[model samples]
Target: MFEKQQVIYLAGGCFWGVEAFISRLKGVNSTEVGYANGNDLAPTYEKVCSGKTGHAETVKATYNPKIIALDEILESFFKIIDPHTRNRQGPDIGTQYRTGIYWQEASQRDTVIKFLRKKQKESSERIVVEAHEISNFYPAEEYHQKYLEKNPQGYCHVDLNLIDDEEFDHLTKEEYEITQLSLTETPFSGKYDDFFEDGVYVDVVNGEVLFSSDDKFDSRCGWPAFSKPISEDAITKHRDFSHGTTRIEVRSAKANSHLGHLFHDGPGGSPRYCINSATLRFIPKQEFDKLQKDKY
Candidate 1:
């Protein structure tokens, strides 16, 4: 049995707003606005605000995953902030107000990695959200906790109207970085680049498998290239000329992300399915075999 409450640390912008926003979540048992991710000893808010302490205003949330999955919590976190922007959230600009995810367990790290990869593949732009292992977390001054609840009229830079449930379905902060903010590449420098031998590379925004290793090949373009999609109906093509060159864009029929361009040139005059490495998840053939066996 899983624990009734799991803790997650998130830093989007002002601690007041983050705390207020998450407090309204159904599964959230409680929210504490505090400071995490810093190298100072009992740093004060003035020092943190000065951008010298490296402390980010964060919210430590206790929630029940049975009521709200970690993914859903992360999705809501992304919708409220600009993940592509570094060291800033809304009108709050500083390292103390930056966005981040601090993981407490190995499983949590893996979950974040998987979500990041899927998000990159689902967006044309890159993702720039930073993720790090949790270190020492120092709670903020006592007055900071639930500050918004105590003083509803307090000045907050966050847009309360921006909090919506629909956007949470498709993108987390990691997805927003790639899809909306156009921040390319994973923040950890592609540390989790591995083609697993199981599962399928479904669309990050929607569950759709556009390609598999069975169709992947070496185009020698320094990226993963597929000869064709798993199913013809799984992908859609559109005219794109954003780079001063006219080309056909490859997109998932469901989760539309700029997968890369298609070229008429290929081995034996076949069309080449050139795709970005950041935009794909490779499930090994062995995993596919097991899945096939279980389908009966």
Candidate 2:
């Protein structure tokens, strides 16, 4: 009962973790680890790892548009890898570990470019991700397929369970309830309600940057309020009819955690984001700058 399926090839480091992570997404139909865009007619893992086959360790993700938008998938990919880095991801270093997005459908090219443009604008460093039409791909060895599933303790840079409900195990009880259950914290009781620091607030589950202090303002709404998010696309807004009233619910785009609600009234009539403090973790400016440099 699924809709037409579309595929994208992603090379975001080791294929094992990439496959494990992407395969668990809501709209994904299937995922396979493989060698992609290589010159060798029959490339093997050993050859590709040598960095001579011109192949990137990639995952082929088949997804249904009716279930998950292509833009969502692109966002998820960005969350897992540092697009500003070249020929590496995590601890892996080599051309084979380079990050890229390969599309087969001609219509998807523009969408990918637009996504990259938005991402580029958000960062000061140049994005090194390769986005283009799929040239060629060969399925990886049988042993490499579903490697994490077979070996639960397998080495993986990514948290394979990030998209699952149980993945919020790292969050505190109140944080988990608010983020995973859409339960709002008491407005005036939030940790950040009166705490304004020169830094950015990030998704508690995945550390994806959500809001900056520059956009935050004291709305006196008994909650941590922000004029706007770091980016319009950073959060997704949905119509909420809970409590017998209609409101716009906001959630983290990558983590899909219930962050807060968006209200129309604010300073200068701008939108006000009433976010839960438990659902976020603040990274100070000094530490955030070091993290950025470490990624390079």
Among these predicted structures, which one has the highest lDDT?
Answer: 2
Q: In model 2, which regions exceed 4 Å deviation?
A: 164-296
Error of 1 at 219 (Å): 77
Give the Cα error of residue 4 in candidate 2, in Å: 0.8
- All candidates: CA RMSD (Å): 19.0, 15.7
List ranges where model 1 is wrong by over 4 Å: 1-3, 162-296
What is the per-residue lDDT of model 1 for residues 193-284, given as tens digits with 9 covering 90 to 100?
A: 33324345655555567777666555655545568888877776665433346777665554445466688677897878866545555455
Candidate 2, run of 10 with poorest lDDT: 235-244
lDDT of 2 by residue, 1-296 (tens): 11356889999999999988887676565577899998998999999989999999999987667568889999988879989889989999999999999998999999999999999999999999999998879888888987886787999998655565566668898887577556678978999999888999999988999999998888888889999899877877766544547888787777777789899899777889999999889999999989999999
Estimate every model's Cα lDDT from 0 to 1. Answer: 0.68, 0.85
TM-score of 1: 0.53
* Superposed Cα RMSD, model 1: 19.0
